[model samples]
Target: MIRAYRNHPYHGRSPLPQTVVAGWLGITQAQLSRVENGPPLVHLDRLTHWATLLKIPESQLWFSLPSRTPTNRTQQIAVDLLAGAPQGIGLSGGSPTTLKATAHEGGGTTDRRQFTALAALAGFGGNSLFDALMLADRKAEVVGMEHVRLASSLVERFRQADAALGADELCDVAMGVHTRLSTWAARSQYSPGLGEALQSALADLANQVAWLAIDGERRQQARPYLNDAITRARIADDPREEVRALACLSLLVREDHPSESLHCAEAALRASRGWATARLRTLLRLRTAHAYAQLNDVGGFDREMTKARHEFDHGPHEDDLPFLQFVTAQELTGIQGLSYLALGRPARAAESFRAISSGPRAGHRRNQVYYTVRLAEAEYRCGDIHSAAQTGLRALPEVRAISSGRTMRHFAQVKSRLDRERSASAREFVDAHGRAFQR
Candidate 1:
C-alpha cells in the first residue's frame, strides 16, 4: 500500500520519495523504509489509521475501520433523531427536520456548521434534530431500556468524539443529552428496572459532560457534574459508573486536594473490587498513582504505577467497558511520563514520553498533541533545550486544530520555559508560534 501510494500517477513518472511518506507518517525515513520492507502491520488501530489516512476503501482493507453504523435499535433511533427524521414520525408526533426548521424560524439561529459538527461528533453526520426532542417544553414520556441504551451509546460516542476532536460542539451536545436523560429518569414514568438503567446511563452522561468541561478547562463546572454523576450512579446501584465518576473526580482535585483525590481513588478501587475489568483496575490504579504523585508519596506512587502498568498490559478483554477504549498502553505511558514530571524525575519522564510511538496517532489526535507537549516539557527540564523546541514544534499544528484548554495551558507553560532558554532553536521556535501560546 505504501509503495502504491508512493508510485501514484500524481507523482508524475517516478515514485514519491520515501522521505516524503516518512514525513507524512511522522516517522523517520529509515522507519518508513523498514515499514515498506518489513512484515505486514498487524495492529488493528494502526491499520485502521493508515487506511483512513490514505483514504483506502474499506472493501480493500483486511480489517474493518471504526464503524459508524448504528449497532442496535436504540442507536438507529438516536441516529435518526440526530439526522433530522422525516416530518411527524417521532415519539412526540413531531418531525426532527420540522423542529430544526421551527427553531430557526424565530430571529434566533444556530450555526448550521455546529449542528453538522455535533452530529458528526456523536458518530453520525448531518444536521441535528435533537432540539425538538430535547426542548424544555416537550412532554416527558415513559422511557424504556431502549431509551436507556440510546443514552448509553451517546455517552460512549461523546467520549470517543472527545478523543478524536476534543470538546467544542461536544460539551454542549452532551449536556443537552444529559438534560433530556435526566428529565426522563426524574419526571417520566418507567418500570423500576428501566428507571435504574436510565439513571445509570444518566450517570455516564454526567460523567462525560464533566470530562468535557475538564478538557475545556471549566474545572469549577466539572465538580458539580461529577458529584451528580456519583449520586446518580449510587441511585442506580452501578459500581462501574460510580467508579468512573470517582476516578474523574480524583484527577480533577488531585492538585489542590491531594488527600481528597487519594480518597476518591481508593473509594473507586474499592467499588470495583469484584467486577472491574483489568482495564478498569488499571485506570483506578493510575488515578491512585496520580494522587500519590501529587502528595509526594514516592513509594505509594511507584507501587501503584507498577501495578497499573502490569494490569494494563495483561488484558483489554471483550468484557471491558466501552469507555475503556481510551485506556491504551500509549496513554498509560503518557500518564506515567506526566506523573514522573510532577515528581521532578524529568530524565525518567523523557524516557517514558519518548517511548510513545506514532502507531496510535490516527484516532488520538488530542492525546498526541497533549503528550507531545509534555514530552517537550520533560526534555526542556532535562536541559535538552533544542530537542524540547523541536518536540514542541511538532505539536504546534495539532494544537491549533484541537480545542483543549488543559493541553494548551500545559503547552503554554512548556513554551514559556523554552522561551527563557538562550538556545537559538528554542528562541526561534518560540517566537515563530508565539501567537498560538497567547492566552
Candidate 2:
C-alpha cells in the first residue's frame, strides 16, 4: 500500500522517492522503510491515522478500527425503543475517519440496509454534533444568502467526499447536514429571496443525501428524502434542483420499476429543456436510455443514447450547473457501457467500457469500482473468461475498500458467472475472495 501510494499518479507518472513519500506521510524515510519492511506494524492509532490520511478504503485494511456504534450498543437501541423512536434510526460519530453506518446492537447486519437519518434528530441526545448545530442555530438571528452560499459550498464538499469515501462513510454525515439545514430553514428568519435560496440549498443537500442513501443501498430510506427534495425544489421554484432530484429518483427506481423510472426521466427532461446546459440534457437523456434498456426497448434505448451522445459532443458551456460538472465524457462512456450491457450488447458494452481507465478518474474510488465491475461483467458476457477473471481480481482491492451496493451487485454478478464457468482462474478468484464476497 505504501509503495502503491508512492506510485499513484497524483504524485507523478513515476514513483516518488522514499524520502518524498515519507515527507508527505510526515515520517522519516528510514521509519517508513522500517514500517514497510519490518514486522507488521501493530500500532492501531498510527495505522488508522495513515489509512485515513491516504484515504485507504476501510474494507482494504488488514484490521478493523474502532466500531462507530455507541459504546453500549444494546443500551442505545433499548433507549431508542423506550423513547418511542421510529424504527431503524441510526447515528454516526462526527469524525470523517470513523464515519460508518454501524450495525445494530446484537446482529451482524449493518444498519444502512434498514436504518437512515430520516428521523436522525430522534437520536440526538447528548451528541456533540447535534449540540454544535443547535448552538449555531441559536446564535444566528437572521438567515441570509451568505448562509445559503456556505451551505452550497458544503454540498459540493459532501459530493466530493462521497466520491472519495463512498456512501458508508458519508451518508450519515450528509444526512445530519441536511437535518441541520432543514432546521435552519424552518427556524430562522430571512427575507423571501433569501428564504428561497435557503430552501434551494436545502433541496440540493437533500438530493445529495438521497444519492448517498441510494449508493448505500438504502433505497427505502432514500425515497422520502428524494420526495422531500422535490417538494423543497418546487417550493423554491428551482427547476434545476427538481430536475436533479427527479433524475436521481429515476436512477434509484430503474431496476425495479422501469416505467416509473422512465416517467421520472421524462419529467426531469421536460423540466430541463430550454434552460439546462447540453451536459445536463445529456445526463437526462442517458437516464432515459437506462430506463429503456431496463424495459428491453432496444429502439428506445438506442434513440435516447444517440441523442445523449450528440448532446455530450456539443461540449461544455459557461451556463452548465455546478452539480453537472461530474457529467464528463468518461462518465458518459461508462454509462453508455452499462446501458449496452443491460441491452444485451456485451460486445459493444465491452468496447465502451474499455475506454474507461483509471487515468483521468484516479482518486475517484467509487467510479473505479463501478467501472471496473461493469467492464468485468461485460468481459464475462463476451465469454472472455480469463480477462473477466483477471479484471474481477483487479477490482477486489477497491471493492473491499468501499461500501457501495450497486458496485457490489455488479461485482457479485460477475463473480457468480465466473463461479459457474468453473475455469481454473475463475475458481481461484472465487476461492481467494470467498470471505469478502460472503453476505
Candidate 3:
C-alpha cells in the first residue's frame, strides 16, 4: 500500500476542501500539495497534522518519513490498528487486502482514479483481537486479577453516573481514573495472561471516558483515547470490546461523515459476526440503522432494524460482555424512533416514541428529555402546533434536570419550529419557555 501511494500519491488527500486541508495542516497550498505528492518525506511539525488530517489509525503512522522503511514493530502496529476495517475505510491505503493502484497522468495530483489490488487484506482476528501482544513466559504480578476486577467495578459505577448525571465534571473524573488505570496496565511484571486481561479492562475503561467526551461534544479530545481503546482492545484479543469501541466511533462520526460512519458501523458488525453476543449485535445494528437513516437509505435502515429486533428478542445471552449493561429495550426503542424521525416520517416517529408509557428512570433521564423533545419536534412537523408547544414545555423540567447540552439543543429546535405557528399556545410557549432556553 505504501509503495502504491508513493507511486500515485493523488489518492492520499482527504475529501475535505484544499483550503481547509491547508489550514488544518498549517501549511501553504504549495506545501500541502507537496505533502500529497509524497516522495513521502515530511518535516516533524507537519507530520502530526498531516497524519491527523488523513485520519490514519495511529499518530505515529508518519508515512512520509524520508527513505527509511519503518521498523517491523512500527509497521505491524500500523497494520494492527487499521486491520479492523481495512477494506471499508477510505484512508490512503484504500483496501489493504486487495488494493489496486493505477498511476494516473502523474502521482502528485488528487486523482479519483481506481486502484485494483491482488487480494483484500485480513490480519489476525477472532474473539481476542490482540491475543498476540503479550510476551511469552512472563510471570503474573501477585495482585493483577484483583486490581482488574476493582477497575471493572469502578467502570460500571462511572457508566451509571454518566447516565444519571450527564457529562459534567464527572467526565473529567472518569478521564483521571482511566489515565491512572492505563498507566498501571503498562507497568512491567505481569504474566502474559494477566497483561492481556488488564489491557482489556483498561481499554474498556478508556472507551467509557471517550464516550463521555463524545457525548459532551469535546470531539477532538475524544478521538485519541478512542484510538488507544481500539489498539488495546485488539491486542487484548477481545473483539467484543473492539466492536464496542468501533461502534462508539461510528456513532460519533455519523453526522459529519455519514458514509465513513456507515463503513465503521458495518466494520463493527463484521468484527463481531462470530463472537458478539446477541445484545452486542443489537447495539451495533442499531448504530448501523441510524447511519443508514442519516444517509436516507431506507432499505438499509429497515434491514438493520429488523436484525436489531431479532437480536433484542433473543438476547441477554450468557456470553454478553458485562460492561455493556446499558443495552436495553428502551435504548433500542429510542434508536428505532430516531431512525424514523431522521427519515422525515413525523407521524411514524411520534408513534414509535408513544411506545414508552412513563417517565424514564434516573439513569435514563437524558433519554427521557431527548425522546420527549423529539416527540415534540415530530408533532410540530406533523402540523400539531399547539400540541408541540405543550409537549415541549412538559419536557423542560427533564431537560433542565439532565444537564445535557444535546437535550438543551433539542429544546431550542422545538422552540424554533413552534415559532413558525401563529396559534395562541405556540406563541405563549415560544415567548415564555422557548425564549428562556434560546438565550
RMSD of each: 16.7, 17.7, 21.7
Off by over 4 Å in 1: 1-112, 126-137, 357-362, 435-439
Model 3 ranges off by over 4 Å: 1-143, 187-189, 357-363, 419-422, 431-439
Quote the positional error of residue 144 for candidate 3 in Å.
3.9
Specify the highest-lDDT model's number: 1
TM-score of each: 0.72, 0.67, 0.63
Quote the positional error of residue 280 for candidate 3 in Å: 1.2
lDDT of 3 at 171: 53
Candidate 1, residues 1-439: lDDT per residue as tens digits? 7899999999899999999888887766865775586433322333445567667788885434554543344444454334332211111232111111112232212433564555565555432234333322234366655566566556666776788777755655565556555655667688764556566777777888889988877676677678778787778776677888999999898988999999999998887885577899999999999889888889999999999989988887644666788788887888888789889999999888888844446467788778888888899899899889998888888888887888888888987788778888988778867766566
Candidate with more favorable, higher TM-score: 2 or 3? 2
Candidates 1 and 3, the one with greater TM-score: 1
Candidate 1 vs candidate 2, lDDT winner:
1
Q: How close to the true structure is residue 327 of candidate 3, measured as C-alpha lDDT?
A: 78
Against the true structure, candidate 1 has what lDDT?
Answer: 0.71
What is the RMSD, in Å, between candidate 1 and the native fold over all Cα?
A: 16.7
